[model samples]
Target: MPKSLSNSYSNNTQPPFMLLIPQEEWQSLHEKLDRLTDMVEKTQRDSSNCDWLESEEARRLLGISPKTWQNYRDQRLIPFSQIGRKIYVNQADIDNFLLRHRIGEHR
Candidate 1:
């Protein structure tokens, strides 16, 4: 059985750590964690042999809203990584995304 974090300390004024997650909230937390895990695995699997770009650079290159970029990742259209709250992506992934989505050609 897993130990509950609610009993961190009884003698300290500000116990090192304490968590009191309600049972109802566990499901929501579980779903969010599952999504995060999927994102992590996708990034890990594609982390080789490509130039990496920051989220800002990729968003600017694509000229799309942050939400759209997020949608792309959620839809498995791109692989990315999150480090300290910032996201990074491989240049080749972005290029392939564009090529797969090309709707016009230059003459």
Candidate 2:
């Protein structure tokens, strides 16, 4: 192969300004990237759905402040999940928590 036609980029001081990919490979890569993006978006939507309530949301639903909510958690009155720095409680658990504290019930 000629020197000018060589594919090596290590000899250049500056990085390659442009990349050339075959049309077929470019299209395939684009499709794969789109699919991965869709999968990530779907996962985020599913995790952040109404079934999992954030701290402020659950507190608002229960009509309590941050301290009271923390106390409830400490006492195990409700169940929660900690993902990274965010806390979440299941909607059904919130419902059960309220029901357990009911003063009187007909049935």
Candidate 3:
């Protein structure tokens, strides 16, 4: 572990890093980043994903009022979450409810 030997090893170690990239690969990376940026802006403007819906949104989707939704929640007929004072519902639960209570049996 002499200082000269250590210095030589450090100099020869190549910084443990790389910047290897073909022209096509760099273009592809740029394209991916641009698409990601566009998606982020679109999502910020209008999030259509059910995962982003709150309780009120979920109720609206069900064509019901907040009070009725609360009743359903209280009755445990629907799955929901309470974080502190905020209530939330899973879109899957809403879909499952519709399917389970739908009319007409299979042929």
Candidate 4:
């Protein structure tokens, strides 16, 4: 056996683990990660700001039947928008509708 192998066996010691990364490279990696995180957060905020639900989705969200949904629209009880022949409701509008209809004592 090699002397080095014999010595390692006798001492029951393994080679030291080392990770070599330059300080500049490490800082650059962190900066890139921060930028990526910021971009992801901004995208999420932008998407949440403009969430548009279709008729079926709006009905499901409000727990109403198709007929009831149509009634609400005819009565102008819910906020909605129409593009061509398709209808869309903003999530914020749905949230506002829910808040307005909430059954509780005023604080």
Candidate 5:
């Protein structure tokens, strides 16, 4: 059975200096943690790579009314991130969004 963390404060005083983990389980856990760390790092890098436009600027770029922009954001039609109280939209995300929603039949 795996040792309990509470064993640290138990009357046993010395407590268990180390806990034993199975070799396979340890390797699997380490790999999973590494993958998670890589994903987080990649996300941070990508978020910082693009030029993020503030709400007003983004609305102007999209040629939409502030209300309309708010509507899209509230409906999740737009992708954005909030820093403190400010909202920022990634330029690439906006471009991709527009391209994805373009009309199929043009007049």
Candidate 6:
């Protein structure tokens, strides 16, 4: 039988094992968690502010086909960044592109 079971059967008097941490170590862990949480929040805020559009999203926003999107890239008509094999555009750049190519009078 296991020591725990033997103890329980024999005496039933042993207290449960407890894990202990020093106050300073616990405080340090809490501080680290807080810092990590702050960093995550800041990252989310920054990403929200500087939104990025993927290739499909840009194509959909422009109402263009994939081939047309590729043509835009080949002709350097749009601003984009290629990371690895994926392309990304800034949301602000897409907005400006639309503004610059507006066809009719604003109402």
Model 6 over residues 1-107: C-alpha lDDT tens digits?
57766666536466557779999999999999999999999999998976998999999999999999999999888899999999999888888889989899689
Q: Write the per-residue lDDT of candidate 2 for residues 1-107, one digit (tens) a residue.
A: 45665655455554446888899999999999999999999988986676888999999999999999999989988999999979999998998988888899589
TM-score of each: 0.48, 0.51, 0.49, 0.54, 0.50, 0.53
- Candidate 1, residues 1-107, lDDT tens digits: the string is 12455465454555355688998799899999999999998887777534789988999999999999889889978899889988899888888989989998778
Q: What is the C-alpha lDDT of each candidate?
A: 0.84, 0.88, 0.81, 0.89, 0.87, 0.89
- lDDT value, candidate 6, whole model: 0.89
RMSD values for the candidates in order, in angstroms, are 15.7, 11.3, 6.7, 16.4, 9.0, 15.0
lDDT of 1: 0.84
For residues 1-107, what per-residue lDDT tens digits would candidate 3 score against the true structure?
56765676655474344688999999999999999999998986764454545888888889998789879988999888889988887777888999998899689
Model 6 scores worst on lDDT over the 10 consecutive residues at 7-16
Among these predictions, the greatest TM-score belongs to: 4
- For model 5, the superposed segments whose C-alpha errors exceed 4 Å read 1-50, 104-107
lDDT of 4 by residue, 1-107 (tens): 56876676545666567798999999999999999999999999998876999999999999999999999999888889999989999888889899999999789
Give the per-residue lDDT digits (tens) of candidate 5, residues 1-107. Answer: 34665554656556446789999999999999999999999998987876788999999988999899989999988789998989999888899998998889877
Please list the residue runs of candidate 6 whose C-alpha ends up more than 4 Å from where it truly belongs after superposition: 1-50
Better of 2 and 3 by TM-score: 2
Tell me which residue pairs clash in candidate 4: none
